[model samples]
Target chain A: MKIKTIPKYTVYLLLVLAASIPLFFDIKMPNKPVDSSAATFKSLMTLEKGDTVLLGTDWTGSTRGESKAELIAILRILMRKEVKFAMWSSADAQSPRCAQDVITEVNAMMKKEGSREYKQWEDWVQAGFYPNSDVAINNVGQDVKKMFSPKRGTDSTGKLRSVMESPVLEKIQKIEDFKLVIDVTASKTSDFHVQFISSHKVPMIFAVTGVMVPETDVYYNSGQIAGFLGGLKGVYDVEVMMDKGLNVPDKDGKIEVASTKVTDQIAGFPGKDNTGSGSKYYPTLHFALALMIVLVVIGNVEMAMARKGAKNS
Target chain B: MNLELYYALSKAAGVVVTVGLFSVLYKENKFYRFCEHLFLGLAAGWAAVGVWTESLHTIWYDRMMGTVDEAGKAQSGGHWIYAALLPVGFMSYMVFSKKHNWMARVPLGIVLGVWSGQQIQAYFDTYGPQVRAGMKPIIGTSGFLVPGADSGINPQVIAANVYWSQAISNFLFMFTLVSVLSYFLFSFEVKNKIILKVNIMGRYLLMIGFGAIFGTTVMMRFTLVIDRMYFIWNEFFYKTLFHGK
Candidate 1:
């Protein structure tokens, strides 16, 4: 049979094998974090303990593979630094649940490792979900206290109190009061944030899907966002940075991750649970990519041969 | 139900449904249809409950009727004015009525009015900086390459002077931007030869951008497939069924 006439199911089966086989083997691929990812790490490292930040969790199960990893990595950093964050969603009704699940999973990992388990109302708080993306974000930018006053969170006593009374948001009278704003999104909520909140001169960061990287780069280049994490590659970059810090040398005087974008040396959690979905799924993704490249080359060669044969006949 | 047993059963059901959905790759079947309908129904039901509990109950109902503390003391007074919004929101459903269809436009118009007002400010907030950032110095003042550009971009040293490499990069970016903008000259006939060539260049540049986007999209789709494989093989088969967690 001609290479051009390969059965479709055969290709699908090959893809399934290529994708699943890599998970069985433990492989660590050499990686260089991109400039944008390096910048995002630097921005996160700049946050100090007890500083509150606004997090917009605007992703659902549809983009869980990437968004979940991104959220876990960022949450690890925040929990390690004891940074307080108030998270809400403006994209979908299910986004808050997806993000909360990842947080719970990360907290479980931390608990298993004998680390501090981040608690609600003290370390972090959920501000709930808003349906209208544009108007919700606009209302947030206009009057944060007024917008969140109606929403309630449980205190240490387990009594429902206004979200404004939560420790994470008590000091946050306006959007500018927050140290930073982060949006992990698979939708247009990031654009809405730029429209309303960026004008307030608040520092913003985004962790977006692969398709959003190109457009998000425009915002990064224009100085609208301080930095951004893009796709699985971005997640992998953060994972590597977390394992070996940027421009920081180990006890053996070896710098595993280095970047010129940041001059100050930042240290990483060396002996910790740093690896997540990014580390696990990235190498497998490479195998799938290689299969695609091989198939493309074969298809091209087959096309040329078929054209030559038709002309000669 | 036991939590462990519940989780195990959940994973087993997930595996069955996943296989059922994948059967569509072979041929159209009832299993695929069943899974599709199940997913739609679940999503719709969840959204309905989520909207009411997460949003409407807290934001609207609580605010309108106010709330009481455990001691039976009034926490906040009820706002009777908020009750008016109910009818206005329900007016959106008037589109189904033949006689009162025009009333639906009122709420839509209000939304549009609010949205358009915000857009006027949002337009500048979003695009103005991008336009400003487009302006770049095409002349090099410093060395051929920025100090640490080879290792990684050093923001400090590069901000003071435009290196030769940056100049060339900036020139290319500017050219592409101008050419692409010129390509959208749809008002009049393009008689100018130089513009026509630039228009062609614009098309090529646009194609390159679109190619990069398409490549990223393909990578994203592959990641999704790989994630599903991980879920099926490792998450379900190895961990749950074989007790390998």
Candidate 2:
């Protein structure tokens, strides 16, 4: 066989190696925060300390590659702003647990940094998994209190209490009362939420995997969603904005991190551990893509050379 | 088992399962099938438990049977009217019965009615804003780029000052939207040459859209594999085995 027609296993091994080698080195990547991501960051920045947001987490380990980083970056920003949030899931049974695990991981990172620990009941509440996203989401829009009255959480004193009674949700009588609602999902939960909740006048955003990007764009462009983090790039957008800030002016009076939606540069946590999945996977993805392109070029070149030789022969 | 021991065991089991699933890439094997079955079983079990704990426990069971306080006294009064829903829900399962298959339509009809009732509002809520947004003006008055702009200027004013560049983009958008809509006109023979060209343009535009979607899907799939690789090397090898930082 020709060099270009290498064994399938050899090709797979080469691709794997290409994808893995970059993990060892720290690559400096240029960050251009998209307008949509900037809008999402701007929306979150608008929330004052102690203000509440609703988080609909509908992803499991399946899409962890993209969703985890999104959750991490968004949570880091939310935690840094001292913004309290209430979380729930409607797509899958394990989604709530997945959210719990990510939050726990992020909290540990926060603890290591000596930041204020985000307390349950006091700061945030987890309204465990709910079935039937459409009706449940509609219920959330119609009767927020009754919808969440059943979910329980632990107070500061370790006492089990209804989630609605928690500081994170005590004043949330309706869906619109929450400063914003963000859906981090791998399923159609974002659409269901849009159909039921966003229609009720609540500002919404999405943190979705890449495949959902094209579809999610319609919502973002339509103004139904405040903004969105689409796929891994969206995670990178959050990371970049958090590092440099949106529309922040440089020493030369130039706006460093520019975004169409944002007016002025709001600074991000410069030195902290804001990098997550996007940071880690992005460079490796480049290497894989480069390999794919190289293989395609080589194959085409080989085929062209063969055709030329045959004509001459 | 102790917490630490349990954690180690869980990690080991996860590694095994991950490898088992990945084995299919090499060749068809029992390991892959076992892992697949394991996932399906776990998902089924978890969903069953979740339905009771997350849904039925509060929405139906507690609502119908009421709740008791710590002292065993009735805390919330139960409404027995909720019991009627049980038969309605159970009727949906009659889809499998030959004799009672028609009864399944009762629940299905109710579902369709509710679903149909919500569609009007749902359609408007979803597409109303989109349709409005699609009406982009193909004219501009202000300069191409707004320099030194700050938060002082009203966004509406800025939006109103559409430049030639913005005008061209909007014109392109309007054209694409119209051409795509025109492509769906398949009722009559399109004799007009202009209409046929527009129809072809729509087909080409749709292909471009699908191409973009397919590209994104490819990226997503690659990211999934990259994540698995990260899990294997960073989490399993470096952290779990070598205890590397």
Candidate 3:
């Protein structure tokens, strides 16, 4: 008997339906953070209040699933830590706006919690986009203020002012002055950041798309980058790490997160919306993966049967 | 306009564009093409504005003309030399014209020179550390499993010592490195059977590596589609229609 296969449309429809289940059903999945993600969280946790960070927002709205969640997680960490940041885009024209959208969303969430709002140009400011990533990041390594001089942002009163004049950037004399440089990208900006800016020796981290993960492993291995958040799993890792921090003591004084390498006990913002795209998309992704595996098996079995039938005939 | 209302409308439009673009996966049609073209046009337009605002206006225009203070006095002296870049940039457009196309190579040469100069330091910055990391020792400094991992008695000290598990991992990594490199040795002929088997092993390992990468790619694509689904359901319809029920 010939094996009947499902139609392409049916498979597509099934996938769409599987992906939608999480939005309707609140199925809590266990998210064990990876080493890189744990390290990423740890790097952020090391920051103190009033410390400045360079946020290279190089992703557009395209990788919003991964990048948006990564940005939200980073912002949650930064806002909770009360660290100042200056964000700019070097990858896409729309990247700065994309960063702003998430920034606004995260800020609103923080405000709802009765935390003081992250003021623009005070708590954090938009440094705008640069035309060339290599040249821009290179310039950033030399002179952060001069590199940011051309781009100006409006303060609360709607007056046009240089980003250099912004309170977020006022104290930052050079690129190395930043407490850390975090490149949240879906492109080669991470490479550019590593190539030029890493020389400044400001501890750097990255949040990249899935395809960039293998290449990122080399950087992680070399210790050129402190840590990275790669794709959706990485996003979930940060979220989970935020939910239950590394080596935190429970009621019985056991390490809560099971990260043996991390001895320093850090706490996460519990009872908050730490569950983001990773928790939702990762479980739903397994359903899609199952479909793929099943389809592959069916195809193989059918091929084998066809070959056997041919031989017999 | 109300911010919430504006945001909701923007999301609704995005959902329509997403569905329109995704329609092509089933079969090609005018809707998908329209959406595709619209996206390209929007991107080109955005980039045009960005090139001016992000680059030329800030780096070139402002530097050349300098800036006036709020008091309307010249705050900084204008540099006349920056204006010369305009002609070089314009000449690059000559590549479209057959007659003066060679003139485009001037700017091209300049760009290539700068890029080549940069790559020397850039290559070291990128691959220098990776080369060092590849030299992992196959020997463990200590035994299997860190001693105090479970007891929570400061895992950091225990972690400093390389255990058997880590040594085994490093050994496997070395094996993979050698095998993969042997497979890529197209320069020399390998008649040795053991070397040949190792080369085959490399090929299989490469296939597995590719499979993992492909798996990651698939997961990412699925997540992207799921995000669009979430946007349509939660952001646009559920949030607006039912007030985030």
Candidate 4:
């Protein structure tokens, strides 16, 4: 076969090789976190201990790359603050399991640090997934008790009871009862959260994949969402802030993460040494992106050459 | 017998799966096809089980059949109202029958009615505040076009309060909003030249917005791939197999 006529398999191998090469070299790319991500980090840092937040985990394993990292970082911050959270999902049936796994992982990390473990049905309860997102959100926004009445589950004591009666949700009366609503989703459910849940004047934050960032930003700019964390970069920013502790000055006394204004309030508080998916994934992302750019350039160059040859002939 | 060995095997499986999936990039081979089928089968299986366990079992069945109370527990019995759901749900399957497709409309109608009732309130709830906030000041006393370092105590507050910057931004926002709205003005011809220009600008701005969104999406996809790579290299190879931690 002619070189140009070589099977598509050759091109695929070449593309795969081009993508994989950067991984071995371990190249680092500079990243400046955007204001949205910075605000998300600062908001989490500013929360007082025991303050309640509503966490809507509406993603499953399909979008684990973006959603998992976002959820993990948010959970870390919430756990660190000793904040109380009520977790729920309206996007998928499997979402609750994903949320539970995240909570368990974060709780395990907290336990290792001699910090308080986030208990189920007490500190945080799974409100369970609803098939109809709009109805569930509307009901919850209007009347927390009535909406959650149909939700039943076993408590820590293994006794069956309504979810609203659980310690995590017993105090929640209205949408405004929770200080913040953080929706970590891979779907358009974040839009629903903003429209229905935030309608009650609740502070909202979004942790969404890259594709959703542009649409999500309209809500952010409109003051409907307090802030947002977008895609992997947002996850990386949170992880960096968590490890270094936001706004804290290094030896140079310069703010490393420029968007955040670090204060003395958390100066001495030590951050957990653990770095999860974000830390590991960030560097690899740079490699993948570099490969993509190279492929784009090559494809364009090839097309241009082909056009030139045809014109000359 | 060793836990470490189990971890190694798991890592190996992950590497195999990753390679198998990536094989499609070269050509659609048996390996790639196998992995693809495996993923589909797994996802479908998971969804099926998940819906039943998390939704049907938890939300439907538990609600329908009242739980049994232990020695010191509450009363338990089945709520017949739940039995009514079966017929309503069964109507959904009528969609497959040409003669009985109208039966499917009953459930659909109920869902639509419930959904429609919420939209009226939801529309205002979603857009009211945004529209109100969009009206911004057009002039400022601050000598600097943008808020300067010496102009105020709280930089953010000064920046926020600056009328000129706010005006410019609001104008841009308002212009875009108007222009985009005008583009959908299909009912009548846009006779005004200015309005025509604004509509054209709106189309360009919309495209730019879409481009930015596409860029973000590309970055997100890269991040996902990077995550898989991290899982293979760090979690599987180093941390798990070598016990690097």
Which ten-residue region of model 1 chain A has the weakest summed lDDT?
A255-264
Give lDDT tens digits, candidate 4, residues B1-245. Answer: 69778868877887888889977776679999998898889778977887776667766786687666455454456687988999999999999999999999999999999989878887886788778877766566455355433323465665556556556766787888888888888999889998899889989988988889888988877666665666777678778877775
Q: What does the interface RMSD come to for each candidate?
A: 1.9, 2.1, 2.0, 3.3
lDDT of model 1 at position B207: 97
DockQ, all candidates in order: 0.64, 0.58, 0.63, 0.47
Give the least accurate 10-residue stretch of model 2 chain A, judged by summed lDDT: A1-10
Per residue, candidate 1 scores C-alpha lDDT tens digits across B1-245 of 99988999988887788888889999999999999888889889888998888888888998999987667788888898889999999899999999999999989999999999999979999999999999989999988966653344556656778889989999999999999999899999999999999999999999999999999998888888888888899888898889895
* Residues B86-190 of candidate 2: C-alpha lDDT, one tens digit per residue: 899999999999999999999999989887887786778778889988988798788776533344576567766777778888899899999999999989989
The alpha-carbon RMSD values of the candidates against the true structure, listed in the order shown, are 1.9, 2.3, 2.0, 3.5
Q: What is the per-residue lDDT of model 2 for residues A57-123, given as tens digits with 9 covering 90 to 100?
A: 9999999999988998889888988999999988998898889888898899899878987887888
Query: How well does candidate 4 match the true structure in TM-score terms?
Result: 0.88
Share of reference contacts found in each model: 0.64, 0.54, 0.61, 0.56
> How much does candidate 2 score in TM-score?
0.95
Which ten-residue region of model 3 chain A has the weakest summed lDDT?
A255-264
Model 3: per-residue Cα lDDT over B115-205, one tens digit each: 8988987999888877888998789897787664356445666766788888999999999989998999898899999999999999999
The clash numbers for all candidates, in the given order, read 0, 2, 0, 1
Model 1 lDDT per residue over A1-313, tens place: 2455778898999999999999898899999888789889988988999999999999987888889889999999998988999999988888888999999998998898788999999999989888999999999999999989888888999788898999889988899999999999999999999999999999999999999999999999889999999999999999998888887766786667876555567777889979888999999999999999998988898888988888898
Tens-place lDDT per residue, model 3, A1-313, is 5655677898888888877876677666765577788788889999999999999999987899989989988998999899999998888888988899898899888888777779897889888788778978888987888889877777767766788888888888998889999999999999998899877889999999888888887788788999999899898888877888776767887665756444566788877767777777777777777877887898898889888988899
How well does candidate 3 match the true structure in TM-score terms? Answer: 0.95
Best-to-worst order by TM-score is: 1, 3, 2, 4
lDDT score of residue A136 within candidate 2: 76
Off by over 4 Å in 3: A1-4, A155-159, B69-73, B147-150
Evaluated on chain A only, model 2 obtains a TM-score of 0.94
